[model samples]
Target: MNDLDKVESILFSQEKRFRLVDIPGAGRGLISTSLIQPGDIILRDKPVILGPGVAEDGTYCSGCGDISGSNLNLMENCSCGLRFCSVSCKQSWHTEEECRIVSSIPEPKPNQNYWLITLRGLVSEDPRIGFLQELTVQEGAGRSKEEDEVVKLLSSFGFKEKSILTVYRQLTANTFRRGRGRGLCAGVAMVNHSCSPNSRVWWDESGSLVLSARVKITPGDEITLTYCSPLLGQPSRRNKLLQSKGFICRCPRCQDGTELGTYMSSIRCTKCKPGLICPVGLDEDKLGWICSSCGFKPNPEKVSGLLKKVEDELYGLEKEKDPGRKLLLIQQYIEKNKKLFSSDHFLQLRAGDLMVGLMNKLAPSTSCIQTKEYYTRQTLKVLETLDPGLSRFKGFQLFKLYQILFEKIVHSAQGSLKAEEQFQLVQDMQTSLLESKFLLSGDRFAPPEIVENANLLVRALNQEQVEQIQDKINQKYKIVKSVYQCI
Candidate 1:
């Protein structure tokens, strides 16, 4: 066997389920031996590396891992018993409790326990703090040399007694959560670097984290997970991940404008038209574009300026008072540029999303035949290109489509539907909900209330339709659960 084959076998044999595989074009990546379907379990691992806990120090807030004290105290402890900078950050941690209790526990070493004791004693004396006393009693009973090293490490990182206690609490709680597992996973140890990754890392409901193929995987694919959520487009995604994770990703998707046939980085050719024609650049590697027809070239500054103007216009329209006027402007802009920019283009997609939002807002309440049919047609056209399983807007759009069709039936049939129409509507709603559930899975940004509402709607649908919706929800749930388990 070749070296890569040997490595792959070793990684996926009975001894191991995963390993880093070398790819020709891509860098080193993780791979799975077994065929993993849409929502199959992959791996459940933890962090092999961790950073210092600065939350409980009162010097740093646990909410966003930000050191800022303002509004930091408002954050509650996470399920893992650690504090985060905010509720959003806490949810991201996927832990059970704030690490306050863990922080109060004594270190399992001779001198180290002294700091733990100090923090615990202070917490105990405060009327507001009886929740962590249990942990204090547990830590006071035993000590270990390893605990000493950890404490010394924390001290070196400038952690005081309060923050040190918090760190200890976080560790202890995570350890307990691990049951019998060893240290964190090597995969999770690899820094998250890109959004449109060749690979994806996910967590399940049970808290296992798993790594899997976000796209197709070959024997030598380098696996990657976006540090930031994938919902954000390329520019914003890259900037945020780089700033927070401290790494600039050179992944194929990040480097090249083409992925899944979408030109994510194209800019309009200003010379061709005042605000319309976009000329595709020489792939994504060579800087600047050579116009296909005119041989005109745009400097980077010009391209950037064009993009800025478009963005500014979009922003201005977002605040416009008249939805109809906004929609008309957007439609005109889209129509003007349709030949130059395909629907898949990022700018065009944004425009389409705005149009969908406007349509939803302006649709007649009772069912105007013309408006209802018009929106249904528009929504279907968009869905042809957009993955209903990925876009949040897709679900709402589908919901609106169904609403329109229902309104049409009501208006024509005088508030009653033929058995066939009823069956068709049920089928459509079920399909839409199923797609939406998958799209919504593992989306931390989507409020739990919204999910619950969607689930309730699914439940109220026809019995035959229920199975399809449940299946989709379960499939996504499994994928998420496996990701958590692997984590």
Candidate 2:
């Protein structure tokens, strides 16, 4: 059978909701065969061949590919000289037969780390590895120096040149990191990419990759996942895709210069108070920007320099490694650059997210609470346009907003507020809690602890228990009422 036919046969056996179909310009992609609702579990597939992802230092276990116990000097007893966490792992993952195969070959040199996964594919009798031949194999220009060494090593072991190249490229394109290791899932590998995807893939508690709907998808609609982070702006997203995935995204979001009205990459224009500067066209590398309200066009080099400087400063802050200091640095950063970019620019949005976690770590202040609330709302507004409808990002943000609101209400002086105003705050917090709970309920990426916390918070703040909850929080803080009166 042809590649498409073979892929179809494999996917059909696993999932009935979607079918493999040839897409123009996109090669092969999965399409929904029936209506799929937001948050529906679409596909769950275990990796066909699991192994350590590309690591040059050989720090991971050969059996389970975990790096945790590598530092404990665990590889000494292994027959094949590969790292294994325990005797069970050595016996189970690197069996005598596999050991014989590994021992026969010369030890690969430094920087030839990609050889490990390719060798695993070649020697294993797994039927799923054979299915990988039907997948696309990228080569030529982007092949790394290490991969060239891999090709020579496989040739010396007498594997065919064609088979070696196919598996090498397949592993490069399709492998998904599951915790400490990486694996290739045949069915999951076929799902294509989009900046604004209708679906997302997450590794479950059992280590299986689960694909779920992010929005309502009708029959015949193509299913996609963002190979890169959804939080990135257009230029960064496209550049990442081109460098890593070997294609430029022409998705709807990438095509629109305004990024579907979120203005994620736009800057505030200095020449016009009410105007924002946006790209004139959809070129991913274009540096020119045009003002929306005025006819002014900024120098491309000037804009690039300013953006680079801001990015460098943020990068420096990220390396701080101390949460308290990092929080302070980001506050200073936002204060410095808040007027340069639009409120919803990706940099601001990302910094806002970082601040959320940092604020939770340190003591809460009235100013911190208000800042957190503003950033949360701004981030939610952008996600509404980019991801929308039961996405994990939006759900997580909603949960955080609920937490911040709960803190605000708890720290407020109960006796000072009018009855109706107090009721409104409670109503808003409850709505956020309910929405977050619904959105994150079945999400594989949502931590069990987070879900449980949401449920517990809901029970704690139930309308009948509000007064008791307030009393408990007030007691826990043990601060004077006047300190909280500012909230």
Candidate No. with top TM-score: 2
Q: RMSD of candidate 1 to the true fold?
A: 13.1
The lDDT of model 2 is 0.73
* Top model number, lDDT: 2
Which ranges of candidate 1 are over 4 A from the true structure? 1-16, 21-28, 45-186, 189-220, 227-259, 262-286, 291-296, 315-344, 351-426, 439-487
Against the hidden reference, what TM-scores do the models get? 0.50, 0.78
Over 1-487, each residue of candidate 1 has an lDDT whose tens digit, in order, gives 8865654453334444356555444344555554444333354554322222321333333322333357546656544344455565445432332244454435532332223222222323222122221222232444344445555645643456455555354233221112112122333433234445544444444444555444343443344555544434445444444333333456555555443334444444446652323333323432344443445666756655665677667768777888778988987877776665534556666676677667766645543445455545554454433232234445445555655555555555654667887777656655654555455456333335446646677667777656656555545434444332211
Q: What is the lDDT of candidate 1?
A: 0.46
Writing each residue's lDDT as its tens digit, candidate 2 over 83-188 gives: 6777765665565666776777766533324676788778777766665433332455644676677877777878887787778877777787655677788888
User: How high is the lDDT of residue 44 in model 2?
Assistant: 86
